[model samples]
Target: MSIRLGLQIPNFSYGIPVADLFPAVKAQAREAEAAGFDTVLLMDHFYQLPGLGAPDEPMLEAYTALGALAQATERVQLSTLVTGNTYRNPTLLAKTITTLDVVSAGRAILGIGAGWFELEHQQLGFDFGTFTERFEKLEEALQIVVPMLHGERPTFSGKWYRTESAINEPRYRDHIPIMLGGSGEKKTFRFAARYADHLNIIADIDLLPGKLDVLRQRCAEIDRDPATLETSVLLTVILDGYGAPSDIGEARSGRAVSGSPEQVADEIKRRVLDVGIDGIILNLPTHGYTPDVITKIGEALRPLVDA
Candidate 1:
């Protein structure tokens, strides 16, 4: 399959006024769709981090933002980069996603992970358990979500959650693709290989092959087909005017896919051929999500792979 591209809207607490942010977000979503991106993702968070801005800042709720995007765009899929498992009950999360999928015309994906950001959870009065306990909670949440998506009444009693025959209405027309986000070698990758339709890993081109090897080994251990899982990387991109290789700064080196269109295209080819990534989610740092960059990349690289 040809590589799919996605756009990640980083949930930075905007120092700019909300009046400016809303229009920019809508415009960017529309621009991404017009650029032929396969998906658009939002980060799930309640409070904004320090240095980025204030604590109780202009952070938009993930589901509500997605609902707005569902009405605004027609083609691009909408999802959280990874929703915190402890944020909401699985049944309710499933129903919320079902509603989004229906409204978006079957363009919703569930990207979920074990809850992280201890400070946020602690401040928000949610349980911040041990790492193992959190993963256990995530596994249970998956059990609830998967069956509920299949139009079944799910009942579960687990360490972190108890649902009494929860039923989901307005059945989804298609199976909402489940995307597991994380690179934990032991538990996270194993869970992705076992259950997820797709997997999201951090964009470290050098470490990708090793990670894939680990994922394949885990898949083998569970007798799962490794190729069944679609692999994607979340890349932070910084597009700048073409410069000499020696002029590149260390800070921008691996943190982003910078340089000219040809240089970026070459890097993408390396990720596919050398690292074996199936897709990439390009995250622009600022509100500089221009359609030109997308067109340039698409023009340069999209035709090379057999779709």
Candidate 2:
């Protein structure tokens, strides 16, 4: 499934009442859908990211929020921007996404990555292993998850995980789309070529063309067609006159696009799509909770993706 013009709701600290938090989240999702976004994603973290807010800031559980979003909206795909593999067991992750697919009538896309963020692990009791170790775990997880999504009960044993005939029933579809997020040419790109249906490259804008070339090489090495693996970039957009922070541009130099809606669209086309990226997933970390801004951004971006 292609995520052309996807909206990622990465911020939950709306400074509103706790009880009314979800209503605000629902509004964003509904507006994104109405404004022609094809997919809506949430970050899978127990705490806010380092740059986004303080650790204690309000952050909803990702799958729980996505499930709730499944009920709140009729269209638009639902998923995490990329689930941290360290957070859950591989077989369990398979079951969880399949359950989401069932709930959303087959609108689930399993976007996963070798999870970063050490504080979450230390605080939450998950083992934060070395970088190489994390990639090993992610590869093993994919072995278990990809098969389970396709209705095969995989019985496997690995250094990090083990499963015995794991079954994921009540599937809405026989297979769910798999999306890998990251720009590591060695591990992430090779795994994407081997296992993922889509790849969400999270590199700097100037590096995208080179990343795409490496991704193509990865696919060639695996005897897979590069076109079969859809691609997208995650862009931070702070529209003009939307309470944007003064330092956002410098803070997110190669990963953000800002200005009037038209200018934002032009920047995205030039910086991302023009470089051969297939699609874009935008998150308004500073001003996303405002529904009108979401509508405007979606209106401006819809044509580019649709074209």
Candidate 3:
């Protein structure tokens, strides 16, 4: 499915009581849906990232939050922007998404990546292997995940994981869309070329055009149409009234879009969509899901995707 315009709720620190956290999260998702956003994304991390806040800050479990979101909202799609593959067994993770699919009436999308957060692994007892190991594990994990999502009982023996004829029952749809997020050219692009339904590029803004080109080349090498795999980018946005901050789009070494809602939408079209990426996923890390801002963005940006 094409994720034309998506909202990513990367921060849950709304200064509310712990009991009210899910409501606050739902407010944003609902607002985004009203604003015409097609998908709602949550980060799949146990701890806050260094760029957003201290690791000890409030971070809800992603799938649980998504399950809750599924009950609370009607139409918007639900998923993690990209789950760290090292966090769960391939089989169980497949089961979880299947359950989410049945529960949400086929709204779940599996977005995964090679694990990157070392501290989470160190503290949580998951093996924090080298970069190579993580990708290998992700590769092996997909072998089980893809088949199971398609209603197959896959039995595989690999360097990292082995599944003994795993089965996922009660599927709402046979083909749950797979989106891979990362910037690694060799592994991520190749695997995405072969496997993913969408590719959410996690990289600097200036780097996107090149990434798109490489992605196209990768698809060509696989004898697949590049357009067949939808593409998007993850960006942070901070608005200054209805205009851009002077340093807007100055996010190569560092990344973010600080602008008025109209400007940010225009910049996305010019910088991202014009550069050939299919869609955009935005994160309002600093603003914490302000409703008006989300709506304004939706009103200004949705047409671009629809057009």
Compared with the true structure, all predictions reach lDDT values of 0.76, 0.90, 0.88
Q: By descending TM-score, how would the candidates be arranged?
A: 2, 3, 1
lDDT, residue 226, candidate 3? 87
Q: Mind giving the per-residue lDDT tens digits that candidate 3 earns over 193-250? A: 9999999998888999899889999999989998799999998877777333243222
Q: Per-residue CA lDDT of candidate 1, range 4-80, in tens? A: 78887775433466677767777778877776777889888887544233566667899999999999999889999
Q: Write model 2 residue lDDT over 31-150, tens digit each, in one string.
A: 999999999999999998876778898999999999999999999999898999999999889989999999999899999999999999999999999999999999999999999999
Scored by TM-score, the top model is 2
Model 2 lDDT vs. the true structure? 0.90
- Off by more than 4 A, model 3: 242-254
TM-score-better candidate, 2 vs 3: 2
Off by over 4 Å in 2: 247-251
Worst lDDT run of 10 residues, candidate 2, spans 244-253
> 15 in model 1: Cα distance from truth in Å?
5.6
Off by over 4 Å in 1: 1-3, 12-16, 49-57, 242-255, 286-301, 304-307
The C-alpha local distance difference test score for the whole of candidate 3 amounts to 0.88
